[model samples]
Target: MRAPHTATTLGSAAPARDGPAQQVARFGRHVAEMCAVMCVTLILTGLAVTAAAAALGTSNPITGAPAATAAVATLALAASMTAWMRYRAMDWRPTLEMAGSTIAAGAVMLTGYAAGVVPADALVGGTCGLACVAMVAVMLFRFRLYASHAHHAPSGH
Candidate 1:
């Protein structure tokens, strides 16, 4: 014979679902984390671009090609973000997705510029802005991965 079904209490061993407010707060925190990541990425890209410009002769990062400059900046952003994610031991899938999105953003701007669609002057702002939005979108899509700090520490103890 089967045992009778019983109603479980709220404080039972089973994990409780977060309330609506708690869910909102968690989402807010996740957004904030992505913002912080974007900020760090921008700072790293800035330093790299400054050095590149200096090395290339105070003309521009790539000289006579704003699209190329934007590409270099985006590459720097992706590289820094990848290194940071690897250091945090985050899953490779999302990390690569984030980085790939950044690259894709730059490529789009480059294509537009090549097609005479995007103004050369707007390449930097357009590429960087789109890349930042893409990164945040990736984080939002994989909230569980981005929201938790469990894998933040390096793998080795």
Candidate 2:
């Protein structure tokens, strides 16, 4: 009968193992990073909307509601993303995709405002703000899905 190995070493003499605490810590760190990214992206989105509205010269612009909405959305996105990244699990692909989409969306809003197409009402502002929020939400869910995977596999010696 083969003896059950206890200290399984991959390449070195050290035994390969990990405790729940370590896993929790790693998850926490990843969550924090995701949240930070979401927050920053949200802030940028709001700024972009404001700048775009200013270019359009709309006094109502949804009564400037989107400006505030963007601010709150960013925060919510950050928190949600963090939790999702930690508990749901996802991959980096979603994050990259979101980054690209965010840039494109911002550009579109800016162009619309510059071209005098978007009105300064809640319609445009709200739409853009909502879009940004949606993007962040997607990012959060995607990352969460990836983060759930066990990353540090025991290096088999």
Candidate 3:
């Protein structure tokens, strides 16, 4: 007698994995996390600029020039984001990777400013804008790190 068919259907069957909906949900969660981290970084960078302006008693140019402001803001952005990530108990590698990428982007812009290639208005736009873009680029390059559910988990949970 012929054997009845079963759900197993063993030969050449595809391995079960997350459905499309589940994949989209996970990606959405990661995007939210990135947004939260970046928002915090930008807010902190603004506070840093405000504090510098207040201390200097002038807003014409923070730290005496646009280039200086760019450098300061870029560092602040990197530091703020790194601090927040570490607070969340994220892995050190990615944290440092992000910080390094931000600093590098700022350095490029600063160089451009020095060379007179970057306009003063662009610097005023905030160096963190470029640094933030770099951070997102790094995230995309390291997709596996950001895509995995474990990376998004809250610490001590």
Winning candidate number (lDDT) = 1
Taking all chains together, each candidate's TM-score versus the true structure is 0.72, 0.39, 0.71
Summing lDDT over every window of 10 consecutive residues in candidate 1, give the lowest-scoring window.
1-10
Clashes of each: 0, 19, 0
Clashes of 3: 0
lDDT against the true structure, per candidate, is 0.72, 0.50, 0.69
lDDT tens digits by residue: candidate 2, 1-157: 2232336577888755545665456556665565566656556655766577778785533466643443444344545543443343333445345544544554555456557675545334444464556565654565433234343222221
Question: By lDDT, is 2 or 3 better?
Answer: 3
Q: Model 3, 56-145: lDDT tens per residue? A: 786656445778777777777678777877765567777888889888988998888889898877874556677767877887787655
Taking the tens digit of each residue's C-alpha lDDT, what string does model 1 give over 1-157? 2232234557797544555676567667766665677677677776777786788777555436686678777887788777877765665776789899899999998999899998888888888889878887887797755544346434332
Root-mean-square deviation per candidate: 7.4, 11.2, 8.9
lDDT of 2 at 29: 69
For model 2, the stretches where C-alpha displacement exceeds 4 angstroms are 1-15, 59-62, 65-157
Top candidate by TM-score? 1
